[model samples]
Target: MAFPIRSAVAALCAGLAATLLTTAPARAEKQEHAWTVSAGAHAPRARITLDDSTGTLNLSVTRDGRTVIEPSPVGIVTEQADTSRELRFLHRKNRTVEERYRTKSGKRLDRRVRMHETRLSFATPAGARLDLLVRASADGVAYRYVLPAGHGDVLGETSAFNLPPDARAWLGTYRADNEGQFTEYTAATAPTGEYSDQALFETAGGYTLLAESDLTGTYSGARLAHDNGSGTYRVKLADARVKTDGPLTTPWRAMVTGDLATVTRSTFTDDLAPASKVADTSWIKPGTVLWTWLAGGRPAGQSLAAQKAYVDYAAERNWPYEAVDAGWYFKTDAWDTTDPDWQTDSWMPELTAYARAKGVGIIVWIHQRELDTPEERAQWLPTLERWGVKGVKIDFMDSEAQPTLKWYDAVLADTAAHHLMVDFHGSTIPKGIQRTWPHVMTLEGVAGEEKRNNTAAHLTTLPFTRNVIGSMDFTPGAFQRVGLRPNSDAAEAGLAVAYESGLQMFAGTPESYDARPLARDFLDQLPAAWDDTRLLAGRPGQEAVLARRSGDRWFLGGVYAGAARTAEVPLTIGSGRWLVETIEDGTGGLVRNRKVLRGGDTLTVDVVAGGGFAGIACPWRPGVTTCHR
Candidate 1:
């Protein structure tokens, strides 16, 4: 709360006094006010604006009735509530809304509507610039990408619907979207054995993952996608369960980004109702990070040998955490636990203690469909809170219905209240929820690690597609060999880097890691945490490279789909002086094929394909630790 450029606080305090004292007098202005209080905004860069009443900003966004930006010491509004802070002031400015309307002819309709939306922008604190715009609408919301003209990224969007309030939701409605044109998209729920799926949303040329307990709630089946240039897009969701008084509308959240598998820098707002239904909004993280996951389902009843094996493998590698998969004690039958009386935490102490000792936290698994109701959630949440668990990897978004979407959101918020992180398996794509709730961590709404038989192109393209929505925990473990076609360990290392998951689930076994010490080098270079990240080179399915930094050490890893290809990686790897670099040529087998001794005085390299690469660069120091931001 560095004093906002003036004796602004003193003046605000005075205004606050006036506001508090005068509240009983005239009911304050019946409108919202314009809020311009931040000098600090982070970026991949975009310009954003919200128009409730033009210049006279009327809607006062408050947390607990007080306006606070995330991580706080910041305010949603810079000035105190005053006579000047009304719609009269907001009316002073004007902006255009970007959208499309419809009619019965299956074409763009000649129509228009004035939307009073709020503007939320993040000024990138001098790194990779990101800019975005947010617009709230009647049915749902739409986000437009600005700042960089060429960026057309697609991210996943997911929601839960009218789940009797007792159930939790791990969603895969994970939708994807872009700025320029639509892209072919996929989710964890898509029926396999298909070329491309049909668009789910019948209104526009878009799709959704509409899962529900019953079929009545569906406006239509989930929107599958096709020919969507990049990947499939999850534009918006309309939960049918929580009916609005006047019209059917989208959820309170929406997001957009640069590409399917690139970094998501811009985020927008979609909530505009007089009173929002999203009260349990506490668990959301405001920014995105590299998140990974590990499953602990089998570890619960296993011999201590298996438990230690799981823990030690993750611990020694510094892989941050693991998701305790379902069946900790026993599996629930097909009964949807709409009541809270069902106990889901039988092995809490044993598993949690096991994870804590290994220095790896557990993201316990839950089946929202099984315990699918608010009462059940209310019943189970308190118990989970008592378990000392770090997060929950919710599963099985079985259908795409409006009520189901709302149920999913409620579950996310509920999980958040218990201070739990999330990894959505059998889910959708990663949308930009990471910006709103950083704790949402990685989502497995796509064809992630769970299904091992996916093609190479699928693996390669995922980096560019699924990554844009922030971190994705696709459960990327791969110790098992694919077929023996003269064998290639190339993908193992590359996928890890290219996958860009903040909370990564290491793909191989400890024995495998040790067998190929080069793999260890890759692990040693991996950051369990990060301050910044950059998508270096290539695109989805073809080739992709990403570099992230933690303090002085930088971790650069990339995966290429097929045979060898040349890639030039340019990173503003901080303004530093460095000569020479070390890289792991491949994993699974020992041989560090590539070494730097040549005109190593300079930076940059030509990396190969089917082969992932990683390195830690530093100021050439002898017998010294590497220090590079």
Candidate 2:
């Protein structure tokens, strides 16, 4: 499972070079060159234009005849030279890629992708070679840099996403851990600060999600920095320089466009990633996890008795896993687990055995400092595996630098060898890592339930911006109103369906969930991995309605952040009648109802500010009017 970095890069460069030499277009003059590539022969197409007429490589994108990205500069700056200008056009090769694959867990199981690609080779005056690869799909446009063979340092990138004058954006401040609040701002009013990798922009044409994908350990992660009064967001690396020995390729800078539905449901990020590396994925399981730390305080909450109770709760609800968070081990110093003074809780083996008897798995937490080195991982992972641990939650990475990213790859490979799934905490936003390592169940990169600022606006905005790129470990379904924002009981339940994660962590305690039988029943039946997904209606920071299907049943969830409003969601999943069961916010607690209706029927529900609803619809069967189990 170890990624052969050098071999993979060399193979990629060789394949690309062979394709260029075979089907490349005739060499054009160095004066000025331009070409346009469209997604496919169909409406709602995405078009990308590559132009170096002004002596600088620039690119632009349009969706269905409307401009989404203006002409912006694009190139990489290396230690040897600045390849942004004074480059000679070598040749251009065009091809079509048709791909179909299945995901271990995500918004959808089956995925089909078709893109028109153009590879433009260029040479600097100093004879250094660089290739720009552009891909256009029905939902978006992506571009990357490929250095066929090189031995230098990549200083930075000169890529800019230029937006129209009147565009507005939902932007999050840059943090190494990728946990922060996102705010809405006008293009002119956006603060001059570092922003996260993903940003959602509302343009005249439609919605455009600016993101990055296919990031590997070889390079540092990047962010977008905007200047006040300027609509251009330039790419900025997390580290000062990325050292490359040979055959280096940068991550893809992608922009997904269309209506809210298209933007929310698009899989452009995963499409650009490498396929799964695991040969046998039957051991990887995606399901709801009953987390202990969130319900009670740490150390005390992670006690053997408390964890055993959590395992019982998970077993009773048919949930597959129980997460035992930090404080299970004692260390005298950082990264000194091998010291004679260090001690690990003796109850872990017994707990794992007890949980296994009830058909529940145990996932233990470990600090990144404890498992950063290969020696440390070799000493710890096998022991945990021998204890029957199903997974590991590694925390406190808080970095996207090259070294930290490299450690991520090593840890994933080691854990995979040990047959253990992974859940990353205090981590960077997902850059298609799940596609490469299917055992990465979920990651904590958002201001989730643990933050006091987890407001209704934050919850609603996540689906379009953060959650669109990959699985998010938001840890929803909290009933205890403590330091978090005030939300209706139904809103908490609705989040279980609205949010998508391979390992969904419910944050409420056993007592809290037991008090509400209706909401508990809903959680018991919700599936973490989905077969299909659709966005019924939504606007960033305002409200959202999402429908997801698992087999023949469809689940609908909606949340409103502003004043009371009525959401009329159309049930267009299929062409037959359905028996629907719903739970919505009531005057006091929650209300449950049932009805029978056919497809295309509109279900209207009035939601108060900070309120929501959750429902399930099953295909109607003759002599069966109730939706049970």
lDDT per residue as tens, model 2, 1-629: 34698889989999999988866554543223776777754323433334445457888877667778888888888887787877878788999989998888889989998988888888876888888888888888899999866537889999988888679889889999999788999765789999997988888668899988888789999999999999899999988999787788999998888888999999999898888899889999999999887787676444888788889989999999999887766434343565553335457889999999999999888889879899888888998999999999899999999999889989989999999999999998778888889999899899988888677888899999988998899888778754465567877888887888999988889888988788898999988689999998788998888889998889888877977777777877888899888888778777887878888898788787788888899988878765658
In candidate 2, which residue pairs get closer than 3 Å at backbone N, Cα or C atoms, i.e. clash?
none
Candidate 2 structure lDDT: 0.84
What is the TM-score (0 to 1) of candidate 1?
A: 0.57
Per-candidate TM-scores read 0.57, 0.92
Instruction: Report the error of model 1 at residue 535, Å.
Output: 2.8
Candidate 2, residue 200: the lDDT equals: 88
lDDT of 1 by residue, 492-513 (tens): 6555655555456664555556
- Model 1 residue runs over 4 Å out of place are 1-243, 247-305, 318-320, 331-345, 484-490, 579-582, 586-588, 593-609, 621-629
